[model samples]
Target chain A: MTQSPVVRLQDVTKKIGGRTIIDRISLEVYPGEVFGFLGPNGSGKTTTIRMMVGLMSITSGDILIGGHSIRKEFPQAIRQVGAIVENPELYRYLTGYQNLVHFARMAPGISRSRIDEVVRLVGMESRIHDKVKRYSLGMRQRLGVAQAVLHRPRLLVLDEPTNGLDPAGIRELRDYLRKLAREEGTAVFVSSHLLSEMELMCDRVAILQKGRVVDIRAVRRDSESSEAAPDDVWFDVERPEEALRVLDGLGKGRIEDGRLAVTADRKTVAEINRKLVEAGFSVYGIRVKTKTLEDQFLEVTRGESVG
Target chain B: MADFLRLLQNENMKIYRRVGTWVMYAFIIGIPLVMSLAIISVTPEDPPSNWLFMFIASNILASLIAIFTVVKAADAVAGEFSQGTIKLLLIRPWRRSSILLSKFLAMLLFGLALTAAAFTVTLVVGTAFFGYTASPEDMFSEMGRKNPWGYMLLWYLYQFISAVAVASFAFMMSAAFRSGGLTIGLSIFILLAGGLITNLLSLLDKPIVKYTLFPHLQLTSYLDGGPGPLPQYPMTLGFSLAVLGVHFAVFVAVAWLAFGRRDVA
Candidate 1:
């Protein structure tokens, strides 16, 4: 059985100034999963996220967060979400600790201990006492994440959290977010135009183009038996020429520079193994390398006009 | 309610920490000091300085406070949008109206504090230099023998109302315009040019123009007991209060609606 979704949108549409920003897009985000929203600039990724969090009103259809309609019960629905859209803004004049304290007040039942805990969680305990104006860009981004999760929200929505970070900062953020999902069981919905970054961070991805979701795919998960199998499989072998001979007549196969590439299913792999053994060819390795999410996303969303 | 109060506290901290707050306080203190020096330099043979002049001059300085307060309030909301802070704010699981109200209340408190400082300084300096030994009754007699205490209270209240009116207008413009300069510039223009526009309209003999908020921006008109530049109309005080009230209500309503529906990308 499928897991229940923490956030669900059905045929949602958004129009601004007589132009459609998002058009009849449907998506579901399950619990404790990092759902990457991938798109190019002006592809309505931000608009869709805003609709899910009730920041932007939906022109048609409905959005439900944990079984609550966002339009009818926005306060309740939005209460479960914590988002940092675009740039993270704090009171520039106030110290980092003071900024957190101020935002903590707005969060119901957020104690002082929790504020300190979030500061520590983001690795900002040392500089949290310093004014935000004095903070570096990386430090500010950490503080932004600290503020977003202060309420222990079920769903954390971030738009391009790594936009301006250095490579080290990006790696730190990626690891921290993974730990958050693994330990805290919080679902993440992140939007970014960087395809490779999404591939590293997301368990599943939804590709949006021209105000519509073009495709949704689960990364690192085997395909279901009911669905069509993947069309391509890559294998690294010791004897590429020998493996190619064994894989012949098992549909189109090629041996390219010690790698055996085949377009076949799992059963075909078993047959290839049996044939290789009979032919006295040692198959050192046979692994089906999955397609990179970037290739799939680009293939799906190419040549689309976006707002 | 607790959440609302927390938001208000956050807004208070934001405004209080700004350099602008200190600048406003300095202006409040500077106004009375300049007036004291001016009064002291004059010959005693000229009309002796009295509490009435002190009151009128202090009230006029309050107008500057009102303008400063309005500029601050305008930036309170619009600046958030331009700086990309609105996104962080909207995702906080609170209603948009609550945030707006918290900022409004903070600005109001700041305005009142500035006005009170100016009033207190003028009173102390006027009392020390002029040696006007007069109770509330004597002060009222000096101002054409009117109800001095009542008029003083009314004047302060009117100043508060005018400040709030200006704040609301600035906030409305801030919501409509993304740039902070545009919001503050338009608000100042409206406040400074309202009288001039009304005067021009009067030359055209448009009786209905008198009812607008322009002619009533002067809080001291209540102390004067009669209209000076504009013709006296029935329920003059009520009409002035009503005009300010309507202006405030309309601006706040528009701000809330516009902000609630805005697409914050």
Candidate 2:
């Protein structure tokens, strides 16, 4: 999109005692984008988010938000950022509105209207005045988002935003986050173990394993080749044996329900189709099954366990 | 300066929002009024001096205020960590030192407010029963410097200093521990047992007891010209203040070091 980066992490590394928790990692999050951070359990995802917001100290390297360095100029850097680490830990004694007001008072120049605007933006207008202890987990999550965006932060960071949400709540959060990025142009940096949600929500995702960024990939349509690898393509032909014979060069063909299923890429599938037509076989239909995000995630992190 | 004020305001709001805070305020004010009523009912003709009445009532209420201060101070930082609100609190524009200082100042303000409330109630109840009469002799039995206003001021000052010591100790514990309940419990134990331990040590007639923090907390005895808690071991007000001052600084320093370096996970 050629937009200036809203958040930048440069060669960040963290060491605890004698063990390194986060190895050198560098990335950027631009405005109007939802960037996903994916990692296995104890892969330093939370630690990295903590360092970004200055909740935990960075052993080395720097994080810049809107060109302000977090290590050297924390107040200036953190001023443009809002975050909720782990869970939204709010005061149960106060109302959701009160919680927002309390946080707004800390951030400079946040007017009452801004508070109201964020409330409406998060769709918490109906129950904003209710005490937080009475609100559900989903409602609290929404309130957390409202508080984080009260000052219209340039970047919003959330660690496991959909931890305890139900399916409907997850969908609502996903849609709201997308809308937030599109409408407000706030760069969102979210970390989660839910690969499906990350696939649907994020424009790009960085996968980490053993405290290292193993891969950075574009998600959804931005991905150059969703079918670059071979997939199972099924063909319903007049003679399954003939189709199997025609596709035998590509991969092993298995017959199921009067159809020949063969593993091949798009090019190979097209070549097989052309070969079948030339061989005088009636090919009624050919369907290519695409791989889901879960399948890809499993393949990428084949040996590692995901929390 | 505005940022500091906002941090203080946020801390104040967090404190005042708790039902426990209001209940504490009520207890501080209510207990004094209730005591005055009982005393008035018992003594029909005795004309107690307003100053004396307030002095006696506040002296008793000061201990209660100390307990409340301990509770408030103990919850200042540790409660935030336990409730997970520290994450939100620390992410603001203010520095951790500023946030910690604000929470400490708010707890002090709460202690001051409770002390003021107790003093005001004592004044009101004493005036209602005995009229506005300042009897220096009735209040101060020690024969030196019979200025009633100065004496009463020193009494309140002593009570406030004691409150600060207890609050600082609790605040240090708060910064050191994550569990608010444990902090409060340990503080209460120290508040009561620490005094007893000092007194027990005083009975040993050792010269080292003079340096302990508990003995120095009794700055009131110096003002009253009394022999003090340990009659054999005497201390000047300056010496006592120096000792308490050292303890206060140590407590605050420990709290700052612990809070500044905490990982905040």
Name the candidate that leads on DockQ.
2
| Candidate 2 per-residue lDDT over residues B179-255, each given as its tens digit | 78988898888777877888799888788998887876667787656666567877677778888899999999999
For model 2, how does the per-residue alpha-carbon lDDT over A46-93 read when each residue is reduced to its tens digit?
999999999888899899999999988899999999898988989999
Span of ten consecutive residues with least summed lDDT in model 1 chain A? A221-230
The residue ranges of model 1 lying beyond 4 angstroms of the native Cα positions read: A1-3, A221-251, A254-260, A263-290, A303-307, B41-53, B135-141, B144-151, B232-235
- List clashing residue pairs in candidate 2: none
User: Which pairs of residues clash in candidate 1, taking residues 3 or more apart in a chain or in different chains?
Assistant: none
Where does candidate 2 chain B have its weakest 10-residue lDDT segment? B136-145
DockQ of each: 0.63, 0.82
Interface root-mean-square deviation, each candidate: 1.6, 1.0
- Deviation (Å) of B111 in candidate 1: 2.1
Reference-based TM-score of each model: 0.87, 0.91
Q: Determine the backbone clash count of candidate 2.
A: 0
